[model samples]
Target: MTPRIGLILFTALLMQCENPVKTPLPGAETIPAQIRQTDCFNGGNALFHAARITEMGNRASGTPGYRRQIDYLKEELAKYGWTCREQGFEKETPQGPVRFVNLRARFGKTPNFLDPVRGLLTCHIDTKQGIDGFTGANDGASGAAAILETARILSGEPARAGNLELVFFDGEESFAEHMDSDDGLYGSRHYASAMQQPLPKWMINLDMVGRQGKKIRIPSMTPQ
Candidate 1:
């Protein structure tokens, strides 16, 4: 999945908020009108955000660059009326116990707005460890940019935006070269464990997306 694909998917999901049916009926015109009314997702803006993220340098978990990235994301989300909370946790990894924080955003001004949402849009924000000069332009930044743009567009549709959550997961990359049960996905794992009952109906996880010439492949076992 490249950035363009991610943007398309996010736009389509928001369209569904207006129409929940799986299949579109004939002469359905509301979606087009909605698109025209709201600020459309801008590919140029997303790329600019991605570039800004990459400029922060290495974002390996527990690093200064990672902290900067988190702060930047929070600032950007706040401008669009998103209230973000840090889901901080400590995990024992192969290297040692590391502190990781997952940023969760909901569309509102209320601090205690813990409502049951319809969907979750997620992406990993940490770059691979032990790599020299690894900016993770496509892997880490692109997905975040896509989500940020989605949040901006959704801000105008409070009714629809309230039924969704945006998450930027940390420590998604493993300390070792390869991932295993003991490593990787630290933030997401903790979040899933801590979530209350009646979770979001669906979730979309984006990673290594937004690269030009990249193609998205669906698994064979995916339901229709």
Candidate 2:
């Protein structure tokens, strides 16, 4: 991956300090300005996808909306010439074993169990279950929208030195109101298990990206 482009893109799309989205963290003063000048990382594009994804109704895992969400993502990514696939699996749930699929888009060969890549950008497409009228506009849709927009932007650029992958996970949220160890992060856990040597050196996971003018909270665990 081109660290300069990827870092700048993610910094613009995800960075948050004490300030709001419009506000810059110290020393990264030129980032937002540079972002505005680029064709990639368009907020409007992300918002458009967010709105469309929201309209699919609640994307609770195992629901028809969730399947439609998958279709939409596959369709959109195919337009950009990226190879797409569904990694389907069945896992036990409170109700029973439910099927889930993770959508992956890549610039190189189809993803293998241990395919090595320079960077992986991902977000959950599944919204929390059991909530009435829960659209997950910010929580579920935002990150996926950002990923879609990122794919569009990156597709137009020249190929990178290493492979790039974009993944939309299907079961990030638990079926229960509150998460239990056995219930959540099904997609990521599966992905991690399948990882091989030379795992992605850089990965960005996005959530709650649609809130207006909200501040970013960089975790203490984040690498400096």
Candidate 3:
């Protein structure tokens, strides 16, 4: 049975690498002049580190840790002149009902339009619970750190006037330990559902950030 499972996993890996989608038109059209001068390959890594400090432990669907994470994001966003707010939603678990919070911030003149909103940067700040001796480090912290640091970098630009929105979603983790239709992506679904105008031309969703050196795998239908 072990050998069979290993073979199946190998096959799946092979299938994934069999075809690489054509690269899409790269973004960052409004990159600031100072960034254009940096020779280092890292576009933004400093700010991401700040976000990792908030999670004392698991940021599961309903917990104090999750609330703290949201507050951290809110504070950071406000420092950048971003108007921030939390949209509340309920998370129902076998244990009980938990109130979830989604932190959304918008920067730019017309948040409702693209002419002002040059792009969107986003990730989840909630940490995952560990059973026994395990606690998430990379899985929960990586993406949040990346986006937070990016927020700092982009907002720091003297010429930073382009439209941008950074959102920290909640309830991304599945109550069942694995994401499925019945248990995950609550925040994103609600945010997307509330949009009365055309969605941003670009949106980045960060999930399962534990693995490093990851290559973004865009869907076949994704614009290239």
Which numbered prediction scores highest in lDDT against the true structure?
Answer: 1
Supply candidate 3's per-residue lDDT for 149. 51
What are the candidates' C-alpha RMSDs?
8.6, 6.4, 11.7
User: Which has the greatest TM-score?
Assistant: 1
lDDT of 3 at 158: 27
Model 1, span 1-224: residue lDDT tens: 33344445665743434553343355522212111223576555677788889999999999999999999999999988999999889999999999999999999888454667778899999999888888998899999987887898889899878888899999989989999998998989998988886777667888887765445465454444
Show the colliding residue pairs in model 3: 24-224, 47-149, 48-145, 48-149, 59-127, 116-163, 117-163, 118-163
Q: For every model shown, what is its TM-score relative to the native structure?
A: 0.82, 0.81, 0.66
Tens-place lDDT digits, model 2, residues 1-224 = 44455565567644323332463354421212212324546676677788888999988888999999999988887766677878888888776788989887786344453567788888999988778888998898999988887777767663652267788888888877778999889988887777788878777788886666655454555555
Each model's lDDT: 0.80, 0.74, 0.56
Off by over 4 Å in 3: 1-51, 108-118, 157-162, 208-212, 215-221
Q: Residue 195 in model 2: shift from native, Å?
A: 1.4
Q: Could you give me the TM-score of model 3 versus the true structure?
A: 0.66
